[model samples]
Target chain A: MIPPRRRLRRPPSAPWTRRRPLPDRVRRRLPLLLVGVAALALGALAFSGIGDGMVYYRTPTELAGHDAGPAGRLRVGGLVLPHSVRAEGDALRFRLSDGVGTVEVLHRGEVPPVFREGQGAVAEGVLGPGGVFRSDRLMVKHSDEYRAAEPAR
Target chain B: MPHRDTCPHSAVAALAASAALVTGLVLAPADAVQGEAQRLMYVHVPAAWTAYTAFTVTAVSGLAVLARRGTVWDRVGRAAAELGAGMTALAVALGMIWGRPVWGVWWTWDPRLVATLAMLLAFLTCLAVRRWHGDAARGARGAAVAGVAGFAMVPVTHFSVLWWRTLHQPPSVLRPPGDVPVDPPMLAALAAGVLAFTLLGCLVVARRVRALDAAAAAPAEHVSRAALGRAA
Candidate 1:
């Protein structure tokens, strides 16, 4: 008694179908993908230019033609000028040059004992009070290339 | 008394939201040191926590989609990743603004900070993979794999303080150390941040899932509409 079109009915939820099963290779590899995403993201962020505070070492020769601003904080890489390292109570003094423009640094902190003239060091801080570069921290520069130094403990 | 499905809103979610709100806004105390400036911590800590939670969810969902070969987990995974990333990005920006004035630096390569930034990038990559990969099934599977691999950063992020003596401090409010402890005021603020965002995360995920369903159903709907038009 009912028309064929009317009687040909599908269940409401049956309209949706589950397609092909995911390949076995993908199933086995999902964990690896997740882990990869986490690592790449972390590594890129760690070394990004987003934080401009940290710096790469540069020599006085490199800074010869450079302009040093009063409020700027950056690493000045150079050999400490001979006999230029001095300390007055709280302020420590040093000079760095790329053999062109020698910049004097006055730091208001304890100077590392190794901070002496002709030493390879980078002063990390701001320039202040008359073209004087003031450093809050200093790092000793060491080359990572392994050299054949005489065997010693 | 029974299921409240008849109501369009989720009562459980609503109640949870209310509780979280009280904790974030009223209970958390102002930092003895930073004072009002410390207020940023409420949203901050929560954003990071929620970001971690969201990424974890993606990993699980990615796995599910791969194993079951269905659209269910794929949709869930993408939704969680996007939402997680949105809040985490917000957290990093807020943290930077807070740090500039206090720490005198806009950013640092501190281990924990580095790890969190990495986590954000990983989530973005997963989303990118999903968008660009061509085949539906293959793309979902590929992204799923990436999601799982990306999770390796989780432990690294959490333990960054222990592993490195970086500038960033370890968990202070959450970790047990301060004599004052987290006062009720501070706790309340943190709770609110968590609640608001968790609900927000769920809300976004649900809406996304529904959208995916509608999009999936569109072809059939279109055919039906055409057929109906012909009949008329």
Candidate 2:
């Protein structure tokens, strides 16, 4: 005959018998609590300085104030000043302006087919001596406005 | 498969999608500035809009699941999330293709681009959470919470262009009053595209919900059949 099992129970006043610190409802919501904490952290990061970093490129006016350390590659975006685009040998030179300031850009590459004067463009390179931007890559930036292409003049 | 009654919505979606393709490709004129590359906007913008709508549905369904504690809402949320993720991926790819020729680069670290990518990752993580846990209730609840939280990325992505100075342009149609700068024909085509994509998204979500429900019931049916055989 198998021995009868003895029941062991903790005293009512024992620490083990005390209620859990967190209620069952709160315990069940732990995952949600973690998510809330994470979202808060991300929001904090975005608002504090990271938001400023999100600006992909700087305008001519901002670039004027920016002091990129020596040899720092920076991107400057603005409207290409009309009649400022001229080719000299293998290099093309133009001035980018945002109406507040202008930066001279020297690019040595095949310009994009869509690049036009008085249109928005971004150039990526370092600033040379005398405030000239030496760009190796040039990109056109289209505006939000859209219209039918006019017939060839 | 969806029930026979849902076939009418599917048919209408198909017809609208066809109309959108015709109008977007053949009828809409090339942009004055970007020329033919602007044509991609019809599909790209619509895909983005559809993704936003799908994610909104997921977020709402998630709230319903949390409030009601029902499998129906969970299934709907999961299906919408899956559809939203796919549309987001499509929009990103189309944007990249458009970017290469027009923007002169395939990708950039622009705020709008980064925020959109973050939104995609957030929903994908929510979907993954649904499969991570062994307990069905726990997994579903966790996913519901995640789905609700992931919606914060949508507004961030939408407003990133406006709040920051990025290479990406600001809103064209969804802006404040008196600022819709698109051509009339182009706007019409774009409107048609958005409608077609939205209807198609709804049809797909409905079918997916039904499929999920059927799959959830299959194991119980199998168990019942086995029990009956044993009794016999």
Best candidate according to TM-score: 2
**What ranges in model 1 sit over 4 Å off?**
A1-153, B1-27, B173-180, B220-232
List the candidates' TM-scores in order: 0.58, 0.81
Across B6-99, the per-residue lDDT of candidate 2 in tens digits comes to 7889789899999899889988899988889999999999999998998998899899989976889998999899899999989999999998
Best candidate, lDDT-wise?
Answer: 2
Candidate 1, DockQ score (0 to 1): 0.05
Encode model 2's per-residue lDDT on A75-148: one tens digit a residue.
78999999999997899999999999998899988687779899999887887777788899888888889899
* Alpha carbon lDDT at B227, candidate 1: 36
Q: How good is the docking of model 1, by CAPRI class? A: incorrect
How many angstroms is residue B49 displaced in model 1 relative to the true structure, after the best TM-score fit? 1.0
